[model samples]
Target: METLVFRFEQGQRRIPTAAQLVGVVSSGNLEVLVSRAELQAACEIEVNTAAIGFAPIWQAVMDDFQARWQLADVRIAINDMGATPAVVSLRLDQAIEACLESAP
Candidate 1:
């Protein structure tokens, strides 16, 4: 699938997360928290990182995430430890996939 530009607007119905999935943040790891929620109008993403001047990069990642999934009321909490953009993206995908796989 092609990556589309990310926009902040009301999304589709919230996708239910079957369980909490965590991706470790190490040399080749990224910690991610994916969960379902009853958001008011948009999805919420909280990204905590040690890297400085990386807000734009994270925004780009979130853009891609919003494009890839219908996270209307989903909550994604991420903890990063100097992981590259590619790694961050990978972890996001992994977290979403895990949620879908575990869904009833």
Candidate 2:
């Protein structure tokens, strides 16, 4: 299994209106955990699986998310196991939803 971890921190600036956390498992699986903290917006993702040769793609996806959402304050952690790109993105969106819903 392989692992990828991406972490982001968002300060007090009204983070995303909604956060979601989705898991993708295909002979592998993905798990994401997001929480609020006192710091800049950030994201932490951890991916674990057997699939290889796709680091840049993963990073690109993440980068795209940041660009699309214009996120500057938040944290994201992803755990993947041979999950497809679509699944990865889905999980990320879900994580964001979760974060927003549990925001205090």
Candidate 3:
């Protein structure tokens, strides 16, 4: 098992109104938990994976996600079990979408 943490400073500080979670940790799958945070124009992501020796790939995937979203003041936790990068991005997007939909 390997764990990685990343923090990014996004100039846009629009936080979601609520927290959300999506996906499940299983063979070739992962779970994502996202929530509001007091990060002050930043986003923090934590990834725990059963697949080792893929830090570079994970970083690339995360970098792409951050670029695409540009979200701020959010904390995301991903429990990964050998999921592909595509699935990882999908789950992350879904979690954020769910969170936004929860807004009143």
Candidate 4:
């Protein structure tokens, strides 16, 4: 297993009050946990993945996610079991949607 962490500083909004978990961690799949945190105007993402030596690819995905969401004071944890990048993006989007739905 490998762990990768990424931080982005362009966040424009803080996450909602409620935390959200989405997807199932299984073969060729992943799970995402999203929540608000004291990130000091940054969005942090931690990925624990079974596929090793893919940091560059994961970094790209993380960069894209940060660009699209611009989340602030948010921490996203992802557990990946050899999932594709597309699946990873999808799960992140789903988690964000579910989390934002609980917004006031």
Best by lDDT: 4
lDDT of 1 at 13: 51
Off by over 4 Å in 1: 1-7, 27-29
Q: Put down candidate 1 lDDT per residue, 1-104, tens digits, no spaces.
A: 11122335687756556446667777465698877766765778887777767777878889887888767767777777788899888888888777777777
lDDT of candidates 1 onward, in order: 0.73, 0.60, 0.85, 0.89
Candidate 2 stretches with Cα past 4 Å from truth are 5-28, 102-104
Superposition error at 20 for model 1 (Å): 2.3
Candidates ranked by lDDT: 4, 3, 1, 2
Per-residue C-alpha lDDT of model 3 across residues 1-104, encoded as one tens digit per residue: 89999999954745556677788896448999898888988999999998999999989988998888888989999999899898998888888788878888
Q: What is the lDDT of candidate 3?
A: 0.85
How many angstroms is residue 79 displaced in model 3 relative to the true structure, after the best TM-score fit?
0.3
Q: Looking at candidate 2, what is the lDDT of residue 14? A: 44
**TM-score of each model, in listed order:** 0.82, 0.64, 0.92, 0.94
Each candidate structure's count of clashing pairs: 0, 42, 0, 0
Report the Cα RMSD per candidate: 5.9, 4.0, 1.5, 1.3
- Pairs that collide, model 3: none
Q: Rank the candidates by TM-score, best first.
A: 4, 3, 1, 2
Model 2 scores what on Cα lDDT? 0.60
Q: In terms of TM-score, how similar is model 3 to the real structure?
A: 0.92
Candidate 2 vs candidate 4, TM-score winner: 4
